[model samples]
Target chain A: MTSKSTSPRRRQQPPIALVILAVAGIAVFIVPLIGLLARTPWRDLPALLTSDVVVDALRISFIASIGATAISAVLGVPLAWLLARVEFPGRSIVRGLVVLPLVLPPVVGGAALLFALGRRGIIGGPLHQMTGLVLPFSIWGVVIAATFVAMPFLVITVEGALRNLDPRFEGAAATLGAGRWTVLRRVTLPMIGPSLAAGLALAWARALGEFGATITFAGNLQGRTQTLPLAVFVALETDRGAAVALSLIMVVISLTVLIVLRERWWRPL
Target chain B: MNPLAGLDAHLVVSRGDEFTLDIRLRVPRGKTVALLGPNGAGKSTVVAALAGLLPLEQGHIALDGRTLDDPDDGVLVPAEERGVGVVFQDYVLFPHLTVVDNVAFGLRSRNVKRGPSTAEAKRWLERFGIADLAGRKPGDLSGGQAQRVALARALITDPDLLLLDEPLAALDATTRVDLRRTLTDHLAQFSGPRMVITHDPTEAFLLADEIHVIENGAITQVGTPDDIRLRPRTPYIADLAGSNLFIGTAHEGTVTVGDHQISVADRHIDGPVLAAVNPRAIVISLAEPGGSSRNSWNTRVERIEHYGDRVRLQTGAPLPLTAEITPAALDDLRIAEGSPVWVSIKATEISVERD
Candidate 1:
């Protein structure tokens, strides 16, 4: 049986031309990472990384990205559940609006946020008058901008997982005397834990790498809104070594997160 | 009947473009009723309706005289508050929780603290003979082990009514036989009105005091195991139990079923009676043979079914009945469906019982 199976498997190999094309596809993703590694200033890395600009940018990026992930978990999970489980009018329209950011340009999303929440804009003007506060070019602005662009990853992922779950588990839980809140907290949440974790990681990664939205909606200031991406953008012209160091830091963080979450994200693929 | 006795339910629910389920059931305290039916016969619908998962369009359900559902009066109790414990098909154990935690879930859901709930769950697991599997997740347990955990979880809540849906359908043949004995013992300990839903006649007969045979969203017959086996009312039940039943008037030594008469050894039975003839008791031949048997008929074969070493044929003619023969005998007779054959049954093989 083993010999007969092996013979057919060997005969089913792909053509050499397709194999060559597949190798070229793989090279397209790897060549750029090799280029970045070749240009690194190995000896001056510590000094370049510890500079005041890089340190401040690191702090702001951490705050904004982590804050965005927390807010997304709070708001996105319920939204995903409602979309997957409930039926109401205009639900498709609401879902399409929620997913609009994933396909919309980041600059356009930032501009839309400015129109809705900027100091001189509609809700922002009345709020500013009441609280005597400003929002644009602040640390809060960076978090809001990151959340706007990053939350759809969490929503769509969680919604898909919710859609695929067998509802019989929830029904069984109910028959076991579990109320609605207890059932959701104990059964529904844990069953989707892997997908939730994967969504959070993807959202955090996207938030950490945010550049266009932050620059458009939140101005680039050293300790306020200048995330790693913006700091790298600013240093690319005058300080190439510092830019390389900042890029390397982001690469390391994103790579570590992806590796830690590889099992959850890779299984479905 | 006492008003505050046990479960008394009349369920009428309609699904769009599909069949409407309309069944009336009553189980006194400390009795088991089996809803036996084939697939698509709405056995699950009965479970869902009684458990408060599906509301009835008409009729009312009362457990110990407390109304659970009445569409006319607009009283519908949710599933969690109904106190109906259902062991769903395939168990549906929580995959993320350990065996102990899954069993403890009922108590925890009722606001019992974790420490006490865990202690109680461990005791239940010990009673089920699975205390060693407490820490293992559902994915690590076998089918029988999962079934025990599911039972433990349902019984922990002290429900007013217990429902087991196809409990033994998921187990292997050997495990099913072993677990069935365990299940019988456990079910005897629960002091409540219980219902077992299954398609297997043997399981129904073994586990239930009374059986309700459902077909196409309706109950066709409700009786004891002996009643269903000896006097099947419908062709489906007769075929299921594999008993060729004849209901007719009995004379001194013979019973006239339809246009034909069957001879039995009993000479005193008279009036209406039910006669059962086992398919294996009938002998089939291609040609007429002289024999000591008192009954013989020339019939055509309507259907032929092979069951491993033996073959069962449905005979069509003046006396339509089922006859079983060995495969070698069937080959020697050179018969197929629609072939003419001779069937004979000894007078001593017929069992006569009151209708």
Candidate 2:
């Protein structure tokens, strides 16, 4: 009995069941934020933020996360371009391996890293003998763990953008006397600027919030390996007020970064 | 020097069983050749091969005495080093860059300084009468404007060879007319040999000094536009050139078509011959009152189409023929679809060619 005009009305307002599901979805995400805000020690926030343990963890977190993001940007973008543009034997397999960290548990990723680069590990053993470097239980180890868990975000984002790019532009550039390097540097990268920004932001945020890999591989050290997430975990056992304060700080920082990135980069073309 | 010393190519591109393009063409410097073919007849493949975008399965391509591709010698220059420019059918301007930058891309890639390249690009834009749109993105331009931008981008490289793939196919009728004029001017200014790929015969005849007719991945004929119009070898070319073609075996001056024999006053061809009849030369009548035209047939109107002031009638066969008549004649005879009619044409009107 439905008419065409009424069908438009039906489309304008989704089914009641779907509306209820949407409300439930929002509640699932927003309720946690509300809980964190309510638990925040607002009266003691300033004091808790300035405490020695919080300051040390925050400094460590900043250094490790930014380091991890820098490494990922330098290496991951090229890997993304390769995965998207090249056709070689075992290409699909290489692509799968690049995205494995996104699905693997962070603790397992840390364990795999440990086996490969630990003091007594396969490649790490020769490295320690030659250069006297031991990575596990150190600040560098923390950055490595963060990169293992977060680099995949940047790679996947940039790779998807690269794959969807209209290759005709490259063809046109080639015919216009551009060498392969020039086209990649000037034309291809500049065109995908927004997606690159988006990928960098996602990777940076993931690095900042990394918890399991940092704890498993780097181990908790008060002024070195313990990032904000690890500090929150240890603080929750003895100082609930400090833990809530640190979590609030982390939430606010990430929210501000994401909003800034969206405004600057992801505007509709 | 030989006249065919500009852009010469003989190539075979195989796309499995779906299609294959086997073509041989040449265009001397300051000349334009049109590769005219129907859709899916592999005109684009020829353009791609010439530009070094697609590798040839066999044969070689050379431009201005330099070998661009030769499978036997392993002297295949990459597309970026081929010194060839192309304006794709869709005018594939970069969606991200400004109009001026898109045009200056070629110069910039060759390490020319920014100031000179931008100035040169701007001048080209002014010539295209689109200097006002220099800062605008391609998404903001109309179809005709985009076409001009594509042309400017290609020509800025000063390439030794240029290829245009259906440059006018993406525009509306009025815009196509305007852009076609602009393209003619630019082609005159470019010194290199240029090849234009198009399916429109009017576009080909208007712009090209020579036409290469391709059908089913092979070049059936290569001649001037008038030559192609006067004698179209294939039925597809005949339709495109607006002539009705009848292919049959000939004995002396008589050609056997289907179940009927028509006498043609042409050179005596012993075996198979192609007979081309101008559609306008054939007259239609309600009654059989033809005096001297022994070349007459009884036919029924299959369809009638209006083309400006003329009505073209497609008729049923002993030998199916398309004939054009004045609209007034159409009304006087009262011919509609399925109306039985007599078609008459003099023997001298039919041009015969050895097949």
iRMSD per prediction, in order: 0.7, 1.0
- The regions of model 1 sitting more than 4 angstroms off are A1-13, A264-269, B243-355
DockQ score of candidate 2?
A: 0.59
Model 1 per-residue lDDT tens digits across residues A94-153? 899989988899988889888988999898899899997777799988999999989999
**Candidate 2, residues B79-133: lDDT per residue as tens digits?**
8899898999899899889999999999999999999999999999998899999
Candidate 2 off by > 4 Å: A1-13, A267-269, B1-4, B243-355
Highest lDDT: give the candidate number: 1
Worst lDDT run of 10 residues, candidate 2 chain B, spans B229-238
Per-candidate local distance difference test: 0.89, 0.87
Each prediction's DockQ against the real complex: 0.62, 0.59
User: Looking at candidate 1, what is the lDDT of residue A213?
Assistant: 83
